[model samples]
Target: MTRFLHDQFAKDYLEELLTPYGTIQSSRPVSSEVREVDLWFSPHPESTLSPDSLGLLARAIQTPAIFEPFRNPATTREIRDCLLKLLEIDAELRRESNRQVSLAPDTSPPHLWILTPTASRTLLGGFGATLDLESWPRGVYFLPPQLRTIIVAIHQLPRTPETLWLRVLGRGRVQTQAIEELEALSPDNPWRANALILLNRLKAHLERNLNPDWEDRQLIMRLSPLFDQQLEAAQLSGLQQGLQQGLQQGLQQGLQQGLQQGLQQGETLVIENLLRFRFGEVDEELAQIIQAILRLPASEFTPLLMQLSREELIERFREE
Candidate 1:
């Protein structure tokens, strides 16, 4: 169960960072075997965000790519499965460019990225992976250019701000240390906001049990102060804005509007996080439904959004 949650968090973390820079297709299916890639990213010519923001992590991805992140060390078999998915994509891209091949050469197919907490020397040797220590940071092993794959050993990565984001995907002490660094980041940082939101959701999930694991309990304790800080800051900002607007719009009406707006924003956050937890990522139609639900009081929308399955939520929200 912990592994499952970690896998989901890795996907969500990658999506949050990469989606603004290009296209992100999560759980993408390939071949006739029905195998799914965790994340398929294709960079855009006109990206809004620079790849450099991702630090050493971004250096590994400069082309169409497939991301397969594991909660623990990935086995040789799992690595092969990731490669097979890339080959299937290669075949499909070739099929599409059959006519174009006569006029111009085709661009290379997507590369596969195996993200794991650790990769043993034997494991790296088995696949003939090489480390480019000078250009790239430590812990990154690349296969021959033809194979177009890289293995990221998260535990081996440097302990710095540049690598902190990737280290959060690691295990045990590494992850705990990364979380501490994450909180130290400026609250206005977008990654900081996204990470905290996911951590809160993770905390909620673990708390459902009467007694969560010791690690989870410790993590929740670490996250609580950050959560309180954000809440307090948001409330203060809302009050200041409300005071200014109240003078012009009449005190009672302006305060009411400000309070409602604040609550609705909270509702939207909860709804989106719950949807992502259950459905991976929300799509356009679902986003619309979430907006509509936000119009309702929190009591009415909260239970419906949290309790329903994807289909059920869509059906119920769409009908209303």
Candidate 2:
């Protein structure tokens, strides 16, 4: 169950970060064996966000690519399964191109990225994976050229901003350290907001399990402060906006009435922000429940916002 949770997080994290630069298809189906590729990404010619901003992760996705992230160290069999998926995709692409005008003589096969927390030297050696450190970074190993596959040993990656995105997919100490780095990035950093939101979602999922392991408990503790900081920030924003609006009304009405109005609006705005962060958007169904949601204290309502599904939340808070 925990493994599936991590897999979902990886897919969500990668899709969020890469969406601006390319087309991202999660759980892409392969024609044979009903195997699914974890992620299939093809870069856009005129992307809104610069690929350079993502550093090494951007480099990996410059071409058509497949991403397979493992929560634990990948065994040999797992690695082969990833390869087979890639080959299946390549064949599928080839057959489709046959029906269209050939653009560049042939379609290039997508590069396969196998990401794992750790990879032993023997494990790499057994697959004949070699490091081209002169061309790439320390932790990345490539199989033979024809294979077009790269195995990233996350634990071996240098602790730097360039590797931060990929490192977030790692486990244990590697993941903990990566998140710490992620938290410290400037608020203006484009990736920071979405990454934190996804991490918070992951935290909520992990917490739902009654018996999380020690590492997950520590992770939950670390993530709690970040959530608080975001909530506080949201409240501050709401208050400022409310006060600005209230002051305009104060000129026509009593100062006390305006201040009371400001407080109410402020709380409402805060709840709206929380809902948006949790569920992407607030539709008419959710809008109907904002007043009901605002009636509860932050401590009481915040968990409901985190743990409940869209339908569940609406059903729980829908106006009578």
Candidate 3:
């Protein structure tokens, strides 16, 4: 199966966000082999990798590479191999750094994280076991709880223009204080306004194409303004179609009812003519029977005519 485009989009999105924090790598071949990693993040040389960074890495690593239907196995295998190599490298790094060099006990190991969107129960089970899980360095860990929680929250939000805006702002560990700083700016803060506009556009693209089914309340509340226009357009289109269909059906039914009534009247006149010719005069009894005959549909009139002879019709129409 071809890998799902959403999976690729998610990977790209996370990579872009995480790049500033650390070195981000994707689909790199492990060693000289055909195997490749989905994503890999290493700490910046100047900064000591914190638990938060490991948390972010974990989120990236755990993000699922959704399988694309009809995708080439070679592609999948290559991706799997790259991920395995990344893990191997992480293990090797830990072994070398922790064992060979005497680093401080408090210093964390270099982390390696993976991303999978729809991880199967079997794959998760495998990770729980020794094949892939054992390669991590001691201090280096996957995405920490906080980062995972944030990612999960973002994932749950509805894929709408508004939700996407909130997501960009909500991602990672930006300070609440910084947000307050932005809020404190006057209406003329061109820089902040421009940033908001760009962010909103990015969110619109993500919502429109990537996660179109997201529906989290938190995300919805934050981004409501951007999505209202699209939502209204869709609703109006649907309403117009419904009204048109309803009007057509009503017109058809009204025409059918009028045609049926006209047919009944014409049939009554035909039955009166047949009675007057056969009996020489129209009587009260014959008139009632003719009325009934006129009301009878054409299909019923044929069967009644087949069963009745001239003599029987005259006798039945004779006054008591």
Q: Give the true-structure RMSD of model 3.
A: 27.6
Report, for every candidate in turn, its global Cα lDDT versus the true structure: 0.74, 0.84, 0.40
Tell me which residue pairs clash in candidate 2.
none
In what order do the candidates fall by TM-score, top score first?
2, 1, 3
- For model 2, the stretches where C-alpha displacement exceeds 4 angstroms are 48-52, 103-108, 276-288, 306-320
**Least well predicted 10-residue stretch by lDDT in candidate 3:** 65-74
Candidate 1 has an lDDT of 0.74
Error of 2 at 258 (Å): 1.5
> What are the models' TM-scores?
0.75, 0.90, 0.31
> In each prediction, how many residue pairs overlap at the backbone (N, C-alpha, C within less than 3 A)?
0, 0, 33
Q: Top model by lDDT, which number?
A: 2
**lDDT tens per residue, model 1, 1-320:** 76676688789788877776678899988877989999988877565454457776575456777889998799999998888888888887777779564422224577888989999999999999999988878898999888889999999999987788789888778988998898888766767776766666565556565756777678777767765665455444544554444444544566677566555454566666656644568888788797677667755665455435567778877876
Higher-ranked by lDDT: 1 or 3:
1
Q: Write the per-residue lDDT of candidate 2 for residues 52-144, one digit (tens) a residue.
A: 588789889778789999987999999999999988877887787797776332245789999999999999999999989897889999999
For every candidate, C-alpha RMSD to the true structure in Å: 5.6, 2.7, 27.6
Which candidate do you rate higher for TM-score, 2 or 3?
A: 2
